[model samples]
Target: MGWISHLCLMNMKRRKTRTFLTILGVVIGVISVVTLLAVGIGVRQEMINTMIDSESICQIRVTGATGGKHKDRMILDQTVKAFQELDDVDSVYPFYELYVTLTNGKYSYDGVITGIPQSELTKKNYTKTSRRTTSNVKPVLVMGDKTASLFYNPDTDQTYDTAEKKKAESWIGKKMDLSFWDSQDSTSVRLEVGAVIDSGEDTYNRDSQSVYCDLDVLKSFLGRLPGGGTVYGQPLDANGNPYKDFVYSGAVVTVDDIDHVDAAVKKLQDMGYTTENEKEYLDTIQKYLKMIQLLLGGIGAIALVVAVIGISNTMTTSVFDRINEIGVLKVLGCDPDELQILFLTEAGIIGAAGGVAGVLLSYGFKGIVDKIAVKMFDLAKGTQIAMIPWELAAGAVVGAILLAICAGYFPARFASKLQPLDAVRNR
Candidate 1:
């Protein structure tokens, strides 16, 4: 096989110009296939990055069932403890939310106040735009940027403009009146703003009207409002006496890894809690990206198909040129299997050369595409339009070699079947 392979390579060099042209066809085909698939890879990565830029994909939102005295369905201190004990679970952040009206000078905002742990603030992308979040022990509220937009002076600016930004900038280190209500009654609490945050922009305006405070501070004022101490709409021991343990309206569970989210959600469901699995969004993204990759790969395969035709043509011509040599080899007791393998090996060598060149050039092409996107569309420097992972490159090379061998099959077979006596015929 080694001698046969060497012979095939030597024969390939005899028709240097023809071989070069055929290899060039394969190179172009490989480049098209790799670059197109790379686009799919790049775009898929972009969507995932956008989704989890400041949020963890391994998180699940858990809430208590509505209208029930069921202890199993409620999110309580015990519930948090149980969630923490789950396998692969990282930590739990339980919080209670209350409707509140915030007032800052002449501006006022109607929003929900979340009482969450200080450690979970940064994990939820609650970065301080007003001041550095040095201490979480303070009894202060962190307002969202959009919430501050409503707190800007009506006379100064009605929209979130430059003036509104300046006004929001001053919203830090100020006091606001936080008023909340229950199904039975309502109350008010005054709290100081610790900082304002940029919770990233979105069309849904999820953070447009939200504020955060420490869990202890929230519990301190919960007793002031009617039904504040209630757990899942059920009062303590049916006696109207406040429960010693604090009740969380909702909680978020963080898994050690995204793959563990499904199992964690299942366990939470079994515990009688309503859960929202963030992994569903990721699964959907994966499905869509797989479809996109297939579509792009199919489109690129058309070019490779044309290159396969070129290989078949080259192999057929080579067989015709080497008809005398084929007859001489057959007469010397060369096996037909070896003859076929020789042609196939030669075709594979051509494919290998072209695939290597194409993969290398694909990297250069990726850089060029990224630069063009940055310059033409004003995309961020970090933005990319193409990505050739090792798997994709290796797959492309293997695919090219197989396709070349397939193309050379008929020519190799024709060469192997030639009669030794017919080789010298002048007809």
Candidate 2:
């Protein structure tokens, strides 16, 4: 080791108790900063992860601009096709939701059915135990994984209990009776379940407890025939003609990337359609997180500022006590710069030691806090409410070292400028 480092070590060793006290103050400050900042980071990350996992980040929900005044201004085919052609528009799916009663044998469930374009439904979106041969007769269907679970016969716990693991194999190919109110009439339709999908890990996945079918099939069930003239008792227009065109309750436009959501929403709004994007909610959440981080960091900075003052005071006292030593060094023709460096090095060592201890203690404290948070908030096990990035850890250590050097600068300067004779005589 160099003389400056060696001398710093010796000085700290000689005044172990005093050095330890100084390091302790820094340690407390670092711990406070790391832990508080970590909490803010952790909360922000959790919220973002939730949005991503729930598949809400890139999906934009667009509805009619007329509110409830004109229900028939439903999103039409040409408009959907136009939206699909837009830049960054990966895909567009028309949504039509209706509260329906699904029945099979003695079991029945009141649920919502959402109709989406059959051609756009990707195989990766669902799992089919047995792929049914394409036939014009059966109306193909995909049911949510949770929705399939409701079909299990509670009387016999055999196949139904284990069906979830098989990806709802028992329900595949079975015809289900669906009943819903279409305007003034109560309508029913029988559809076949072609596949069952894993809607996500969350219990409240939108598809859970719901069925998905071709948009055309759903429209037909509602008495709106595709080819024309109110055959299934569809509502007539003012001209006493059946509405042949398909009308969507809403349209879900997915952007190619999350960053492009604002652009897509803006374009849709300019076209006179009301839209809602989860990114808006995410933006609000991010602002709140920034505020929280600032509040936490400010609280911790106050502690660090106090520690800096303590370090400055300790170095000043050390300079006074080492007056005779400084005089001997000056007599030996030790450079003024070297004297200043030695004192600064000593402070840096104390800060480094404290910073390392504080970081380790912060991690341990984080573990305890996470455990308490999980239990108190009923969060999933292993969920950490405080997260400390490597950048923060390294920065904290480096910051402490720099702060110490700055704090000790004036004291070191005073010691370096001391005259050999005066220092010796004063001592």
Candidate 3:
């Protein structure tokens, strides 16, 4: 071993009790910081999981223009075409919803419907569970995975798991009669079920609980079909009229990539369109998350600061015990800087070792806490309350070493300045 390292080791070993106690203090401090940091990270992640990815990051929801030059104009085909040509735009889809009554023989049910182009209903991420089969006889529509449960034999129990589920499974390729009441009259038609979407595991997995039909087919049979879900639905127009040139209330504008959402949104806003993108809201949430993490870290820092004092105290005591040795080394021409480095290195080693042990223990403690939280709380299965990222783990060890070096500075300076005559006489 190098002389400096050897001297540091000897100095620390000479006061094994004090060194061990000092290390213990550092370990407790590190455990407190690392575990709390993990908890903060975990909570922030959970919040992100709950709020983010619920909608497409690159898609924006746009309503009728109420500002700029296109004020008070209705959203229509031209608007979709205009949006599609904007910079970074991938595609734009115009859609309208309806509260309608549907029937398969005697199984009549009330539900919601969306009229969108067939091109839109066929996109991979947007929709695509079962392949669509061609049939020239009648227009086809796709049903949600759960929509089948709405139509079932009345004589049998209407439970979703029983007859409803079995009957819903048989709805693929079947014909269903649909009716919509407009402002002036009622219109009806029959539509075949082209395919059924696979069940969604989450809440917002692309129309997983609704129905969608070709816009052209729906327009032919619709006459100012009411909007909204209530019995007294919101009317789209005052007079009953055909939807050959219907105006859309809102649209979904998709950007080519997530990196282009800002540019696309700017273009839309410049055109007097108001847009809402879930990704834009994430920045606001992240601001609050940073504040929470800072608070948690501050609480843990209290313990770590206390540990720094312990290191300082141990180094100062070691200096007094080794006065004679330090004086002899100086008389033999040892540099004062070397003595300082030796003390700092010794303290740093103890701090780093303590930090490593604490990190390992923090991981074990996290596992225990997570299990207890899952069992005692209403959290979903496999939920974690504490999570230590690799960045945090590496930082803790580095921080411990730096803090120890700082704590040892004063004692190292004191030892380096001791006069050989004065130190030898005192010994």
Taking every candidate in turn, the Cα RMSD to the unseen true structure, in Å, is 4.7, 5.8, 6.1
For residue 187, model 2's alpha carbon misses the true position, in angstroms, by: 8.7
What is candidate 1's lDDT per residue for 74-176, written digit by digit as tens?
Answer: 6788888888999999889898877666666566666577878867665444445435443433357776666655554568655443444563446676666
Give the candidates in order of TM-score, highest first: 1, 2, 3
The digit string of per-residue lDDT tens for model 2 on 1-427 reads: 2988887888878888888889999999999999999999999998888887755689889887323334345477777888899999998878876666777765566666777766755532665544662334444677777665565455765333254454454678888787654434455567777777766555555565567777666665555433344543233456666556655667999898888999999999887788988789899999989999999999998898888888999899999989999999999989999999999998898889988999999999899989999999889999989999999999999999999889999999999999999999987
What are the lDDT figures for the candidates, one per model? Answer: 0.76, 0.78, 0.74
For model 1, the local distance difference test gives: 0.76
Ranking by lDDT: 2, 1, 3
Overall local distance difference test of candidate 3: 0.74
**lDDT accuracy of residue 186 in candidate 3:** 58
| Per-residue alpha-carbon lDDT of candidate 3 for residues 127-153, written as tens digits (9 for 90 to 100) | 333355333344476777666556655
Best candidate according to lDDT: 2
Error of 3 at 339 (Å): 2.8
lDDT accuracy of residue 145 in candidate 1 = 66
- How many pairs of residues in model 3 come into backbone collision? 0
Weakest lDDT window of 10 consecutive positions for candidate 1: 129-138
TM-score for model 3?
A: 0.72
